[model samples]
Target chain A: MKLVCSKANLLNGVQIVSKAVPSKTTMSILECILVDTTNGEIKLTANDMELGIETTIEGQIVEKGIIALDAKIFLEIVRKLPDSDITIETDASFKTVITCEKAKFTIIGKSGEDFSYLPAVERDDSIVISQFTLKELVRQTIFSISDNDNNKLMTGELFDINGDEFKIVSLDGHRISIRKIQMKNSYAPKKVVVPGKTLNEVSKILPGDADSDVTISFTEKHIVFEFDKTVVVSRLIEGEYFKIDQMLSSDYETKVKVNKKEFLSCIDRATLLVKEGDKKPIIVNITDNGMELKINSALGSMNEEIDIQKQGKDLMIGFNPKFLIDALRVIDDEEVDLYMVNPKAPCFIKNVEESYIYLILPVNFTTVA
Target chain B: MKLVCSKANLLNGVQIVSKAVPSKTTMSILECILVDTTNGEIKLTANDMELGIETTIEGQIVEKGIIALDAKIFLEIVRKLPDSDITIETDASFKTVITCEKAKFTIIGKSGEDFSYLPAVERDDSIVISQFTLKELVRQTIFSISDNDNNKLMTGELFDINGDEFKIVSLDGHRISIRKIQMKNSYAPKKVVVPGKTLNEVSKILPGDADSDVTISFTEKHIVFEFDKTVVVSRLIEGEYFKIDQMLSSDYETKVKVNKKEFLSCIDRATLLVKEGDKKPIIVNITDNGMELKINSALGSMNEEIDIQKQGKDLMIGFNPKFLIDALRVIDDEEVDLYMVNPKAPCFIKNVEESYIYLILPVNFTTVA
Candidate 1:
């Protein structure tokens, strides 16, 4: 295979797919990236069995062939090459030669026949969404996904679609985050739980511009993401997601509207008193004109009051400061309404439009005086 | 202890001393920072037994008292506090109250008597050097220090002071680096081996202004550095540093002057051909017009020619790319003179005055052809 590509274009293509390259796999072939020019285009692919990424290079194809090279070495060579046209050629013996300017590299390449390619699924049921919306949805709810693999289902986020409205929910037993948005085009209702890792990698590769749209197709065993001349196929987790709606309730005895920035900073400061391995929770006390955030630990105690518009009964509750900070950080609204039923019930941070809702269970504190 | 200090000043002072705080120590008090409001100044000190740092904070001393607080929590609290003035007061029971704006913190403090302080050294044999000069000298030679603790002397750099010239030498068995600078003032001859860790921390806290001076005092077993209202006392490694001067010789068969940037980049690109467990040496071939940098491995081979001013006999030598890059990265000269005796002996990168010298032993490549 022979191809002449711009250094920048080749480097970008390699970087996008290298993220899925298996670093520590029993099969050594998984560590390599396959450069396929069989279809008159140079396509770079990397697969870790569970997730796979394939990106096309914008270059002129001189010959037609296929070869797999070590992803790590290939990336380093392409990145260090001069900012000009790079010529890559592979011989019948699979010896690959890469040249840029006066620099040339001859790296031993593995036979492409041994390389595993991403499974191709029929694009029968697919949804089109703006790249910006998908990126934002992943960033807002992905953090709430449980990192522990004991309960495999919790490690993935639930993507539920109903008519034109799409909702993504993530829960880690301690806290839950839900983000709902309206799609421009309506489609069949579908629900799928996607591994958090796959979403994170997709978010990184997506373009920053909002004009571009990404096509997401769902199959029985896999989900395919196509955008920006790249296709990503990730294996879906086989399990039923939790019924997040049943876990969320609107009943509350106290409701407070507080500035998001002020509330976030107050809880952040209170968290300083608690050290790692310590489950010290910050207590929030709602009064007539303001709310106070407090954290008491063996090392220290901190309290900060933020002014807010309060309604309903005065309440006191304790929660993990990190849970609140995580939810508050993703809420783009200036003011967030916090609803609390009692000290034992969960506290909810939601907006009036019900587009985004965050529920954090309060910690049972014995020393709340 | 009672003091009202600006949040920025308190944070800066705490950060400087916190570096000396022992993170994992048998003595719990070593992890705490002492806040002493005595001698009409609020002084913060942290000691890890082997190394200690003390800095006076800019604040108003309301009452003369002393207490030790957890360094990690104190720094976090001060950093998150309002940018206004922060008032910290300790009660008789050692319950410290820190207040800034509407935020308040009550942390448990230990008695200051249990905290170990930096040894007070007499200003007997001390030399005053510009902070910039000292910082530059450490930056130029510290990378050559051995990270291994097997040979403790190699983990420290030798500071030799003679007449008005101060020379620093560091060697890690494989390579040796020497930096010498003429001091503005003459002092008694002294030689001390300062631990690389201490120099790194001192470099971080030095003021950026070149006019500021740092007073370095040498004792029988310790080295004290005083600068910018902070004093760092570190126990010197007790051993004789390697005789690096004898290891370096002016005798050579070939001398080449090459552009430092070009040589460094060529070697860096060649390193891409090598893997972790492989020690592929980059061979430098000197000729009448230029120098050719080449690296051959089982995976591939790369050769790049860089134009240089050559003299003497044509030669070829192999050396580790990392060692050459390390020395070239720190040198201030645009064009560096490389002197080599043969393919087996060490290659010396030095100048005419010998102000800076880096000697790297050649790696014997069996596959050299």
Candidate 2:
């Protein structure tokens, strides 16, 4: 394979596909990135059995061929190359030569036939969604997914699509985060559980602007996301996601509207006394005029008060500060409403118009004093 | 202690002293920062046995008292507090109360008497120097300090003061780096070995600009640095430094002058083909017009050439790329001269006016082919 490409274009293509390259794998071929110059385009592909990525770069091709090179070394070489045109050529014996300006590198390459290709799926059932909205959905909900591998289902987020609305939900027993967005056009109903790792990688590579759209297709075992000259295919977790709707309720004895920034700051301060091994909880007391947050530990105690507009009965509750901080950080609104059924039930942070809700389970406390 | 200070001032003071706070120490009191409001000044002090730091913060003293609080918790509380005047008060029992704006914290504190005090060093043998130059001297030679603990003397840099010049030297058995600067005034000659860790911390806290000066005093067992509103006292490493001057020679068969940046980039690229376990050396071939750098490994080979002005005989030599890269990265000169004695002896990178020299031993290579 012989190709001449700009350093910037080649670097971008290699980085995008390298996300799928396994750092350590049982098969040595999985650690290599397959470089192919075919169909008048240069493509770099990497597959780690569970995830695969392929990205194309615009280049001048002298000949069409295929070869696989160690992803780590290849990436370093490309990144360190001077900002000029880079010529990469490989012979039938898989001897790859890369040269740029005064620098030249000759590295041994493996046959591309041993590398696995991304599994192709039918595109008839694909759905096109705004890349911006898709990235936001993952960023808002992915943090709630369980990191513990004991419950494999909890380690993935459920993508539920029906008609023109798409709902993404993630829960880790302690909290549940759900983001719902409306698609421009209607589509068939479908449900798929995507591994948290795949969603994270997709979010990183997705375009930041809303001008572009990402086409997503899901099969029985795999889900594919294609955007910006790049395609990502990941294995879907085979299990039924928990029914999260049953755990959410609109009924509440107390409702308070507070500034999100102020509330986050108060809780963050209260957590200062909470040590690493200490399972201390922050207590929230909502009154008609304002709210009081307090945390007491063997080391010390903290109390902070922020004015708020409240309705319904006065309530007191305790919760893990990290869960509240996590939900509040992703919220982009100025004012947020907190709905509490009682001190024993979960507290829901809701934005009715945005169709977003974060439910944080309260810690049972005997007394505030 | 009772005092009222701006949140920013308190945070700065805590951060400065917290560097000496040991993460885990046999004496638990060493983990706490001592806060004292005596003589109408708010002082924060922390000692980790090997090093001690004390800094004063501007504040209004409501009453005179003293207490020791957990350094980590105190710093966090001050950092998260609103940017307003903070009120900190401690009772006779050492229970501390810190209040800022609408936030209030009551943390457990120990008696100030339990905190170790900074060792007092006589100022008779003190030397005044620009903080900026001291920081630069540390940065230029600290990387060459031995990370291995086998030779404790090599883990520190020798500070040789003679007449009106200050020279710092560090060697790690593989290479020797020396940085020398002229002091404004002459003084009695003194030599001391400062631990690399102490130099690193001093560099971090020193002001970047040359507006301020640091007063350094050395005692039999300890060294003290006083600057700005802070004081740092550290234990000195005791041992005789190696005679590095004998290892350097002026005789050479080849001398080459090349652009520092170009040489560094070429060496960096050649290192890409070198594996973790592979002790591959980059061979430098110097000619009258240009220089060629080559690296060969089982994986592949890399060759790069950069134009240079050469004097003396043409020569070929091999050396570890890392040692060369480290010295070149710290050099500030645009054009650097290299003096080599055959392919077996050490090579010297020197700037006579700057009083900076780096001597790197050559790696024996059988053939360049």
Candidate 3:
């Protein structure tokens, strides 16, 4: 295999594909990046069985061939090399030589035939979406997904599509987050549960530009995200997601509109008394004079007051400060409305148009001193 | 105690003094910061027996008293509070209340009598120097100081003051780095060894601007640094330093000058093949054309050619790339001259006026295939 590429172009391609490379693996071939200069394009591919990424970088291919090199070493060499034309050539024995300006490196590579290729899937069931929206959806909800595998269904997010309305829901046992956006066209209803790890990685690599679009195609066991010159494919989680429709409701005994920034800041300050990993609840007492957030822990006691416009009956409840801060941080609106049924029930926060809804179960704090 | 102060000013004082507060200790008072307002100033102090720090914060003292609070909690509370006038008050029971705008915190504090005070040190011996110069000197040579306490003297830098010329030297057996700067006036000769940990902490808090100045005073067992309403006192490491004057030689069998940046880059790229914690040597072969740097390891082999001006007979040598990188990274010169005696001898790098000198020992690599 022979190729001449600029340092900048090659480095970009390597960084994108490296996200799919497993840090530690029993099979040596799984840690290698397949560099193929066949079919008139220079493509780099990395597959870890569960997730695979590939991209074609701009380069002048002198000879059409294939070879697999250690991703870690190749990346470091390319990143530290001077910004000049880099020539990469490999012989039949897999002895590769990389030269750039006055620096040269000679390393051994494995045959590309030993690498595992991404599993093929049909792309007929496709949906087009904006990259900006997809990134926002993933960032705003990925945190609510369970990190452990105790409940396999909760480790992934449910992507529900029905006609022009599309929504993504993620829930741990404690809370559920839903983001809904309008589609450009109506289509048949479809549902798929995507592993949280895949969406997390995809979100990191996706560019936040409104104009660029990504075509997403899903099969029975696989899903693909195509944007720009890169394609990310991952296996879908095989399980039935929870039916959360009954959990999300518009009924409320008390509601209040508070400044988003002020509420987030208040909760953040109240949490200063709560030690990390401790579930000390932040008690919210709403009266005629806005609201007062309080927390008492082993460290100390803190109380923060925030002015808000209250409606309906006044109520006092306790919640995990982290859940409130997480939802409030991603909200761009100046003011947000929160509804509550009672002190023991879950708190609901949503917009008037139903774009996004956050439900957090209140923690019991009756035994506190 | 009762006082009102701006969050910004109080936080700055807390941060500086908190550095001396030990993270973990059996005596809880060592982890607390003493706040004293009795002398018409809001003074904060922290002492860990080995080192002590104190700084006076700007505040309006409404009541004269004293108390000690946990450094970690106080710092966090001040950092997250709103940028408003913060009022801190304590009663006879040591129940401290800190209020800022609409937020308030109630915590327990210890009696000020339990806090350890900084020891009195005679300040008869003093030297004034630019803060910018002191910071730069510490940064350039501190990397060479030994981290382990196996050899007590190697863990500190030798500060030798001879009249108007002052020099500091640090060595870790493998390499010796020396930095010298001229003083404004001549004084009595004095020598001391400051602990690397002290210098490192001092550098972090020192302002890099050229206009500021710092007063340094050394005693038999302790050293003091006073600047900008803050004082840092640390215990000095005792023992005799190594005699390295004989190693700083001017005679050479082969000499060469190369672009500092290009040479550094070449060596950095060559070290990519060396695994972490592995001692791989970069071989240098100098002749008429210039120099060739080569490295062969289990991963790969790399050879780079750099142009230089030769002044003597050809020579070949091998060195640990890290030693070269450390010196080159700190030197702010466009071109550097290297003087070598033989393949097994050390390399000397210095300026015409001997402002700074770096000596790196060559390694034996004749047995490698």
TM-score of every model? 0.94, 0.96, 0.98
Best by DockQ: 3
Q: Write the per-residue lDDT of candidate 2 for residues B70-122, one digit (tens) a residue.
A: 89889999999999999998888888899998999998899998778888778
Clashing pairs in 1: none
Q: What is the lDDT of residue B349 in candidate 2?
A: 97
Ranked by lDDT, the better of candidates 2 and 3 is 3
Tell me chain A's TM-score in each of the predictions. Answer: 0.97, 0.97, 0.97
Q: Candidate 2 chain B, which ten residues in sequence have the lowest lDDT sum? A: B360-369
In model 2, how well does chain A match by TM-score?
A: 0.97
Task: Write down the lDDT that model 1 would get.
Answer: 0.90
The number of clashing residue pairs in model 3 is 0
A1-369 per-residue lDDT for model 3 (tens digits) = 799999999999998898899999999998999999988899999999999999999999999999999999999999999999999999999999999999999999999999999888799998999999999999989999999899988999999999988899999999999999998987689999999989988998887689999889999999999999999999999977899998988899889999999899888888988888988999999898889999999998998899999988888898999999988987889999999989989899999998999999998876355
Task: Put down candidate 1 lDDT per residue, A1-369, tens digits, no spaces.
Answer: 899999999999999999899779999899999999999988999999999999998999999899999998899999998799999999999888898877878889999999998887888899989999999999999989999999998999898988998999999998999999999999899999899999999999998468999999999989999998999999999988998778889898999999998888888888877878899988888999589888888777888889999999998888888888999999999999999999988889998888999999999876656
Over B92-191, each residue of candidate 3 has an lDDT whose tens digit, in order, gives 9999999999999999999999998999999889888899999999999999999989998899999899998889999999999999999888868988
User: Order of all candidates by lDDT, from best down to worst?
Assistant: 3, 2, 1
Range of the 10 consecutive residues with the lowest summed lDDT in candidate 1 chain A = A360-369
